[model samples]
Target: MSTPSYHPAAVALQAVLALANETEREVADRLGLNLTDYRALSTLSQSGPMTVGNLAVKLGATAATTTAIVSRLQSRGYAERLRGEGDRRHVHVSATAAASRDIMNLMRPLMDATNRHLESLPAAQQDAVAGFLHTARHLMQNHLNTLSTKDTA
Candidate 1:
């Protein structure tokens, strides 16, 4: 028999994920980078150097996947992995200057569009939207943490 139909919630979530990924991927493809690399570069641009494990967690990805992303970025000269001087095993990754500029340039249009759209909303509504996004992000993080814990148990 065919698989059962997904619930309404599942369908909505699938659509949201697909839409967001499709939009981001399209932009990234044009910029010669995948979503992972773009996200990693953006994160590094904001947060400076970070451990691979921390990067993986921040990216909501596995270490192996993040490692692959770091490897690709390294190969492209967009990022570098640096070992801490005092701690030999402490490895950190950061974006190259070129990568920082590229991400900002690539995201400029998206940022402008988002800002314009948000500006169209009433002031209170814009604040509400920002609050909602913050809460949504926290909720998603909690859900991911639960899933990860369950998966490895």
Candidate 2:
């Protein structure tokens, strides 16, 4: 059998993913958080305050596991749970100001590195990269949803 042709785009995508994973690991270590904890905090930072059930769904974690994650964050003073006034059962988890600051500090280096690379690109190339990433994210989300449904079945 002949060797398959190598695609530069495919190789670049793989390298980008590997670098991102390494960045995540570095940030998590700097913040003294496990990968799951860091991911939960990252999600909370992006999505703002959300109920535990909603967070669990987002994290693909069970209710018990989510609760434990929340508890850990709460104990570390990184997060807090707010109970609704009218509906006490409605609990929402939010990152504390300190947690947000810490996360930002931990991520600043990676963000700066990525920004430097992006800034070096021409405007048109930057736009093209952004569009490609947006489409890639959407496609990944669709694939994940399909796999999730299959696993549940």
Candidate 3:
């Protein structure tokens, strides 16, 4: 077989994703959380309160699994469950203030480091990087939507 050529952009993108995943895993470890719990915490922190079904969608977990995760978080005092006003059966999960603070403390250093690195780049390069990330995010979201639709079908 002939040797295959690799695109620089593809390699760089893969490296970036791998680095991000590794960093997240390290942060999760430092927080004494598994990857799934960490991801659920992240979603709650970013999205405020959401129903279990919504959180399940966000976490790509089933309702039963998300409930167990929420239970664990509640036991740890990291999350709270709120009952809906009109419908007592409807429940929403939110990250507690302590959880938010802890997550911020854990992530601030990484955010600052990334910001410093971005600052070292030229303004034009920084803008290009931002644009590329925005585009990549949208493309990935579209692909995820397609996959979800296919799964449902």
Candidate 4:
């Protein structure tokens, strides 16, 4: 019976995820949003306006679930559903200015600290770190896709 050892980078990634989860929870509480609603608002804030169907896809939620999330956000003044200009029938969900401002205000301190830390690293190191994060994000997305497929199956 031998113990298995994880790679240091993998352990560090886990730590990052744990901290990020905690941060998200705190932010959600402060914003008076549930985890899913905060996530939906964050996605809309970052990705701009998208249809409910598109948001559902992005959030890995069902259309009904996304609609409910949108409704909650609408009630909180964090999101709005806008009719398309060209196609009046097309509905798009967008994060309100208030949502954007609140999220940014909550996250700015962390972002600034992260930027400062990155700036202290050499350019080569910074690039390497960025590349590693990109790969990590891709791998996580693949895993998420696998899990979702398994759920469907």
Query: Top model by TM-score, which number?
Result: 4
Model 3 steric clash total: 0
Number of residue pairs clashing in candidate 2, backbone atoms closer than 3 angstroms, sequence gap of 3 or more or interchain: 0
**Which lDDT tens digits does candidate 4 get at residues 1-153?**
998899999999999999999999999999999999999999999999999999999998899999999999999899999998899999999999999999999999999999999999999999999999999999999998899899989
TM-score of 1: 0.70
* Per-prediction TM-score to the true structure, in the order listed: 0.70, 0.87, 0.85, 0.96
Report the error of model 4 at residue 123, Å: 0.7
Residue-by-residue lDDT tens digits, candidate 2, 1-153: 998887887678779889889988888888889999989988888789999999999999998999999999899888899998899988999988898998898778878998999999999999999998999789878988999999999
State the lDDT of candidate 1 residue by residue for 1-153, as single tens digits.
899998875578668778877877876786688777888877888899999999998998899999999999899898999999998899999998888887778778878999999999999999988986787678888998999889989
Off by over 4 Å in 2: 1-6
- Weakest 10 consecutive residues of candidate 1 by summed lDDT: 8-17
For all candidates in order, the CA lDDT equals 0.86, 0.90, 0.92, 0.97
Top candidate, metric lDDT: 4
lDDT of 2 at 11: 75
lDDT of 3: 0.92
Each prediction's Cα RMSD?
4.4, 2.0, 2.3, 1.0
lDDT of 4 at 134: 98
- Between candidates 2 and 3, name the one with more favorable lDDT: 3
Pairs with backbone N, CA or C atoms under 3 Å apart (clashes), candidate 4: none
